[model samples]
Target chain A: MALQDKYAELLQTATTLGVGNLASTEQAGVLHVSGTANSTADYDALWALYAKIDPNMASGDLMMNIDIKADAGAQLKVTTDSSNLNIRSTPSTEGEIVGKAAHDEIVTLVEKTDDSWWKIKTADGEEGYAFAQYLSPL
Target chain B: MKLTKLLMVVVVSATMLFVSCKPKDADIKAAVEKALSADPSMSGTTVEVKDGVVTMGGECKDDACKAGCEKIAAGVKGVKSVVNNCTVAPPPPPPPASLSTTIDATKMQQVKDGLKDIAGVTVEFVGDKAVLKGEVTQANRMKIMQMLAAAKVLSDVSGLTDKK
Candidate 1:
């Protein structure tokens, strides 16, 4: 069976979940689907559904590029150079400054708003996105 | 000397027979109940001893508690076998939906981050209160409660399955 047809359930589920900017294509017997889920729960749900359909995710027949917002499961550390990092409300420098993280403070990465910005929350309950450059995986 | 030896043997044998023939139901029941009451798991259990056989019956919080009652019963003196009839209590129902519908998104997110790496647990805002559920140690539960309390958020913590 064609990979696209084989993965119709996943595509239908993504659409049903109201994923934004959804795109799908097939090439070389592989199906690639990309989209942005509004929340981490939605993204995780999609991954779970995918796993149910393809248990090991080993099929290589599909590629997923779903972006999850509000991703609190990731642990990261701030690596700013001798200065604290600002946690902004949005994924932009002009976004409201809701909190700040000291340099080298380990923070929970909540979301990858984009390549340039990451949403993080400190241990004290302050949450906002920081510049991606200053954040490092712990 | 030989007559004294015979008399000693008779006394020892009679004592042994008398001791063996004595019914130990009361002692066995007392010991089993003592053991059960000492264990927190067997809180609501009751034991009956009849002819060296034990019958345990009551409600336990879970299967482990039910099994613990049987083990305590079997270990009692003169208990030849245990007839376990304890029933495991069903898990309490989830909190009322009113408890979850009014959660503050920002505070809920904060609670989630504060409890990183703790498995099988979730916290959410319920109106002005934060409700915690799933597996969490008492120490961690108190810690989380303190953090939220300091945050000026009231919290109701329950459904804590203490880690084994």
Candidate 2:
């Protein structure tokens, strides 16, 4: 409950932003929150608020698992920090690098394979799984 | 004229007797509700009675509860029949696990892959915890945390310092 009090503003902001399936639970001294943000901007706003509330996020008392809402055939933007994002044969990086989607490129989502990986197809017809961390739903 | 007055009195008494013999719709509704209240699962059900016919409304936890409510209402005194209009509620979704405690090889590789692009940061898996030590910008720091969370990997970023 104390963790709930500490992050009340974050929870309020999430509700205000209309995050879908929002849920929160406190366990083992850490507050775990999971939901799907309506858009990438909303997701970024929540993370920004989290950082502000916990400076440098040093306390480690919260685990926010919010992700952007995207469905099959939805447009996704490649957000790699300059280099082309790797499209692998499988969800893990251990899989072969089958293709690549350039930074800031738009691709179509085939499916959300898992929390960390998504199967995507680029304009050039290259299709494979990529890290979801670098793909923002548009 | 006296015979005509006696005939009017007989007709009035007969009507009174017929009305008193049957229970009122309101009384039947109360009885049905009382019976339904015996089961906690039927708490959401609502009862309405018109002409001794009971109509069950609202949500029931499942089909069994809906049928049970209808049977209970039909058994009530003076209820001619029951119209079970109660809807069955969908089962609640399973709660999401708060954290993934296992640190399998795949999870460890995922942590390594997430850190590959970010320079100056190195990670070591100590027990189930991913201990990260290095300097990272504010944006990268957030990215690191999000990546770890997506992989469901518990981490120790206390050793990570802000890159000025």
Best by TM-score: 2
- Residues A1-138 of candidate 2 have per-residue lDDT tens digits of 599999999999999999887888887777888888999999989999999998887777888878789999999999998999999998887789999999999999999997778999999999999998899999
| lDDT: worst 10-residue window of model 1 chain B | B93-102
Residue A50 accuracy (lDDT) in model 2: 92
Chain B structural similarity as TM-score, candidate 1: 0.53
Alpha-carbon shift of residue B6 in model 1 (angstroms): 2.4
User: Which residue runs of candidate 2 sit more than 4 Å off their true CA positions?
Assistant: B1-17, B58-64, B80-93
Report the lDDT tens digits of candidate 2 across residue range B1-164: 99999999999999999899799998888888889899999999999999988899999999999998998898887989888899999875334454644788888887888888999999998986789999999989999988877777777899999998
- Model 2 steric clash pairs: none
Clashing pairs in 1: A71-A110, B103-B125
Please give the clash total of every predicted structure, in order: 2, 0
Looking at model 1, residue A101 earns an lDDT score of: 94
- For residues A1-138, what per-residue lDDT tens digits would candidate 1 score against the true structure? 887677889889889998877777675454656666776568657877765786434354555655544345667778665688889887665589899999889899877764446778899999988776566654
Q: Residues B1-164, candidate 1, lDDT per residue (tens digit)?
A: 99999999999999999997775899888888888888887878888888889998888899999888898788877789999899899775332222222335554554565555356778766656566678766545434543443233445554445666
lDDT of model 2, residue A16? 100
